[model samples]
Target chain A: MTDASNYSLLLDEIAAELDIPPSKYAQAVQRYTSVGEWLCGDDNSDCMDDPDVYPQGSFRLGTIVRPLKDGKESDYDIDLVFEIKKEKYATTSKEIKERVGTRLNNHGTYRRLLKPEGRRCWTLEYSETDDVGFHLDILPAIPKTPRTGAIHITHRSGNGTYEWSTSNPKGYAQWFEAKNITAFITLEKTQKNMLFESNRELFSSVDDVPNQLIKTPLQRTIQILKRHRDQRFANHPSHSSKPISMIITTLAAQLYSNETTTFEALKNIVFKLDAHANLQQHDFILEKSLADQKLILRTPDDKWIIPNPVAPEENFADRWHENNHERAKMFFQWVKWVREDLVDILAKRSVAQLTESIEPFFGERAVKMASSRLPFLTAPGIITLIPTNTPHIEITNPPKPWSK
Target chain B: MKEIVERHFQELVSEFKYLSLVHEEPEIFSIQGNIEFTSSYSEEIIHDSYNITIFIPSDYPNSPPCAQETGGRIHPSFHTHNEGTLCLASNIETVRIFDENRTLMHFVKALLIPYLHQHSYYEKYGKMPFGELSHGAKGIVEYYGEYFNTSNPIITLLLLKIIAEDNYRGHSICPCGSGKKIRICHGEKLLALKKLKPNSFFVYEYAECVFDGLESDSIPTELKSNYIYKKISNKNVWQHRSTTHSPTK
Candidate 1:
């Protein structure tokens, strides 16, 4: 759990420097929504909408990103929840442990600290002071469930505001087919003190996200801005990579804190470092549907997710749509030398030079040519889809259904 | 059934005519009688040291035993990251002794029995094996004067991990077994010892791991007449598992 007061102090300091009201914390909520919505409806096929994600026990399905109490000013962990749902769940813990142990025994390392306990819970860790090795854990949590076998999820507004919802996933799926408001739910009673259910959604964990929606991407344009922003900041001085701590600090200080994140800014960042980042990922999937095409966008159960554009009908395998005249050979080398110092700076700044300042470097060949070659981007098949029903209209391949 | 393994183990130890080594390293003497089998491990663990802890599940033979490790003290590989528990291939619990046609006598004599004196750090106050620098632990054979014999650390971190993981799926093997794998013999006591000093790698006395069944003739007092066979038994599954020889506190 994080000490909110401690973070409020840090946020207060930043606010003083920016001359923004402390209540501006409200804006973060909007940014989060934008990130989520953008991911759900991006051009990349990796963004997925999964009705199939369900918790077996006391586990919840989203990521918990918050400040840490370690006081190092930058230490934190991304905690996730998962538990077994069957009568044999207890036995599952031991089995899960053995599965991991078997792999370690085969891999072999130099030294270590930590061993499995008898009854429940197992962790694998390493420390230079006490021990030196990487650690992983399989913790057991006893979930609180209703005897009647129904599930409930709750939401909180800023300060005293609050909202709650009850759901029977089995029934929700049947109904989701008839409605399209975007179903949300939670399988865990609590996620960092903010209770999550199987239906209600909250991106920043802060309440009242719908009203404060500017920081969020109201449309698709923000996605492109964010990609470009990410690429421009990929390389900056002061970036370190030996121990993981430095990279983590850089991430929190330079990336997650940014409220001005845009889709294009992000695309430029991703395009340079890893052009194939979400190449194999899909947007969504249509399961057991009457539609002739079952292809639905696929989403992953990971921390970061986003939407990508389908290739324009005019452009196929040719990524050289706009820059056919420019030599692509030298461009690839420049991207290979990326670092995260720029990301650190971007994490705090509201605008990026990639879209405004750096766009001119590529000239006319950069902006307009990309669409001339490729029609639609194809997501990989790494995700699983169990869709009930989602809206879909056939793409006639004209300006590539994306424009229409 | 590690028991079939136990039988072949029994025959292997019987072949060393208790008195034969008398002609070799005279400091060690024996009047060959029944040799005990102790300690066995899965081949999956590919770490620094060969030492392992195999857990014997309740349903023996039919159900495969689980292999685990501890201390992360040593490893032939970096399998166990920290908590020093490595798990090996599982669900294979049939009596499997290396060579089928070999008699227990030939097995023990030909394969084990030599491990008893493999490197007895017991002679020293647990300091013979190592220093704090070379390897994290103490009390092991100084292989090459710098590292423990099996790289100076008798138990590698990887082997420890494999054994620790084994406990999850199988039973722990007490190092004090007569000569059997901890799984088939006195495994409960070993499990109890888990919490004592799990992460304290250097504190565990390697000498204690040596199963000293018969009294050392050098100690005198209780050999039928004075010519008691002082044989340091080779490592056989039964001998490693035997609870008959109590561990000296």
Candidate 2:
């Protein structure tokens, strides 16, 4: 086995630099909660006692990375799924979208921030701030039951046809949370105790603990991977169809062995993810006509699918079939890049070499800042050749070969 | 030679705080210690120290010292040879760079430190930072490529094959694709190289990496006589796994 200390140290430094600061996280929490409160209180819409205005996506999974800037703005996408009672299940998609849009438009604070209605969610773009700034994508959804298993929401297909589409954000988030509950709990206890010691008023009891406040190895690994993916594909806007967050989260969770260290977890998850895909191939039923040699992601039973853990009908790999498996190819390419970068970084000794290896994955600024935090580290100095008086070996010829 | 060896040992013990000369003689001297290596500029300790021994041969400055990790905590990527001899540099490189006037400090800082750094790094991480040079023949070809200032491994292989021969007539074409006579082209360099690598086995080993294998006639008489073909075993399930997901696009 390798020493593993340097690897762990480097990952820890990257995580410390990348993870959202507690103050900024709290600000984001306050902003999104305010949006939720405003939607419920507005008399213009039918947002009653508990109109499910909770986070979904990365924030909910506790794998949120500081988003890249868009032009002059550094915007965070805080996806808040707003689900009301299913009393009006037959309501038109347009009507459902407009209802939430109308409520947000009427609110004094939200009126200026409300963006033009999109196909599905109503975007509320917040202005930039010093540390953090984000927009709330309020997806107006109606759940089958109040507990959130399956749901119907507005979706805009090509040719601008708005219609009811199926989704299960709450179920998906709950399933993701369950993937590493034990590790989360252990991390939660340590983090909470630390917070309590610093300030007892921060959290009263364990019951009120917020998941986002604690960072688990699994969570940090996902965040780092996501950030790397974002940077990797920043230039290739066309391949924006790269593997989505849900697929990455699901695959990572499936392969994560709850390794205590972020370095081990990241390495294990990345290596095991491709292997898990290979396992998926073995389990999948083959087509008689089509050769089953290549790496294909599909359901073992019949049709190609990366089924949502919450709602099996919703295939997260929906685009894979149409895109000619470009997504699948790109996913593995990314995994290879991650592995190589990790290996190169850990194997490097000098700070310059370390920075050079990591800059490609985690942006230049992030690497520079993270590497600086390493203790007793000295920058590599330029070497000037000093003439030496060492004696050289006298050149001699070997015995003549058969005179060719 | 004895004065050169003694002087080098003295320089090493003086410069490196953790090192001290243990045994000494006119022909051979041995030194062992905890080598506390630090970065060039920062001078900050890199990591867990290494317990090592340096054995200087009678040839002194003409032949570099044989340094080894005596602690047995060596990483495979460190290129530690049998009996813990550190493969610090290629044989030709050692000969070309070795100088009689260079101090033990010069040798340790230039050769020994880098090797130990690589060992430390490989211990922490499973891979070498700058990829390794394979030992023996393969290594000779690699160094020869750099020594000749040619990036093409094929040409380097050819150069080795040609150099392994005893005579090159003045009118013979150069192996470098230059139509000029060998005497007018690379004759001087080839004559010099004869001192460094006298064997043509390096060319065969290098050829195997570049192509499938060389024909018997294509191999030099020295190499072809001793060449033994080893059968390759079938790939396991992991190799097949790569084929299943091999990037198509």
Candidate 3:
């Protein structure tokens, strides 16, 4: 077929490789549910009255990617909100944090799996021996009054002092869902039908298949962007200042306009975000549009604001103005990188060229996976023509030497 | 310092299994190793390996380490300095890359591995993989000329002067004779280069460029009045007098 189609197919394959496998997804759900039941189970004396446990973050959003730690593929971090029905002001942050810790400590299995207390959540590490291992970060939270689906989770500063931090994962998810509605509506039936057909033994009908398993182009695009961000900052000193998954997801969701393909969605999102980041270089129309929407705001004093859609007070870019806007600078640099690595490279290059171009950013395994699946689409001869050691063109901005 | 060096060495050795620590002193740490790479795409096996020694100074993360070809496979013609250290990249480039990923593993993977691969590719093909640059001062001028997107060395030097002084006036006249403002011309590039390092670094680079121009007799007549030329001329005078007064001669 054409090179554009090949690029799209290659992206789809790479994103698929990065995605959480169905078996792992099921295991995550089962494990988190069991942990939830154990917390509110009758055996525990200090169990909460009405404890609600559910997956949040990427897991709930269906944008999970196999995380890389120390440059190696590590466990999936499944964040679960172990929220309770208690009044927010009735208890202290320390008490809620301790209550969850104590309950998990009460269980022999959970206590063994439980890591040292995190700043906010209690981590349960599932070893790789358990098959496609994952970690569940159970956030102990109490409901925030007058704000629907918002909860005040505990935060522990470096000085070992605890404070209440407000988050609305549920509300954020709803906002994301609203943005993804058009694409979701278009793809839901077919995805559920496919799911039911594949797992005939588990589901009685297509309707019985859970909605979480259905992924739209928007979800897949977020997954790819997150993986790119992770790889870009893998070993860099700017790792701490790298663009966070929340901002990536939020921007992707906002820019996503029911693109039918993952490649289209990702390209548009990166292009638009790059334009938004470097507004002065772009056209006045885009600047006016951004100003009208106020999605990404730049104040007169050079402060940046990327507000949380659900909680307007919680700026995703709160730290962007700090350290001479290092976070903001790095975010734009990353966008430039994504633009180069993903969009520019994939424009009209051959399958082999595209694979080689993306290998450094997406890693060899994903590239190999994409390459292996390419012969069916393109001629085998084209695939065999992959160069062993192609020379790079002379770089435009070459580095200066010491003596010379 | 020793502990930090040891830790970085350990990290480097962990990822690169063939590399091992050879020598360790308070100020210097060395590792001798062989790196191997085989292409994943080719069914017909192609493997390249190189034996090398890496010398990391105590003040690393600020300064870059040096690598030498212990196997003598790579000739000096292939970008090795007269002292036999592999010219993997420009010092400032190394600092920039290392700053981005301040890990020994990244140093080896990003810089050393590519250098070796380029050398090996050159050996097999009888040409450099990525085109080569002139050895000493001329290469630096060529690099900056490309960096500022100006073929004229004079414009490049002016941009370097701006960077060295850290005085970027966006609304000032463009140095490229474009008759536009600096911001409309090359202001963004200047700002980017400025952010890469401090003004002091660019000051040294500017002096080096001037010295290079003088040595090659390539300095245009207009630059005779430039401040960099005056600074170098003063230093040259002091050096000439000091050498003339040496009694050992």
The best candidate by lDDT is: 3
Model 2 lDDT tens row, A1-404: 12255446666667656666556667778888888887777564444546767888887777777777541215677788887764554567777777778778788878898887777898888776574567778888877655666678888776877788778777777777787787887788888666556544655766455667677788878887887887777777645766788878887876677888887888777766555344334454444322232223464443356667677666777766455556666777778777767643443323333456677777777777776776433232221112122222121211110000
- Name the lDDT value of residue A5 in candidate 1: 22
lDDT by residue for model 1 over A1-404, one digit each (tens)? 01122222222222122121123222322322332243234232321322022222101111111121221111112111122232323333344334323433433331133354423323333332322112233332222253423333222334533233233433322322222112121211222233222113444443433221222211111222222222333342311111122111112222221222223223244333334223233443223331222111222531221111121121111222123312122223333332222222222111211222333322233322332222121112211121123112221111100000
Alpha carbon lDDT of each predicted model:
0.25, 0.62, 0.74
**Which candidate do you rate higher for lDDT, 2 or 3?**
3
Better of 1 and 3 by DockQ: 3
User: On TM-score, who's better, 1 or 3?
Assistant: 3
The C-alpha local distance difference test score for the whole of candidate 2 amounts to 0.62
Scoring model 1 with DockQ, what do you get? 0.00
Error of 2 at B7 (Å): 16
Candidate 3 global lDDT:
0.74
Regions of model 2 farther than 4 Å from truth:
A1-3, A43-50, A70-73, A88-90, A145-148, A158-160, A195-209, A274-304, A321-324, A350-352, A377-404, B1-249
lDDT value, candidate 1, whole model: 0.25
Best to worst by TM-score, what's the order? 3, 2, 1
Q: Where is model 1 chain A poorest over a 10-residue stretch in terms of lDDT?
A: A395-404
TM-score of chain A of 2: 0.80
Cα RMSD over interface residues, candidate 2: 12.7
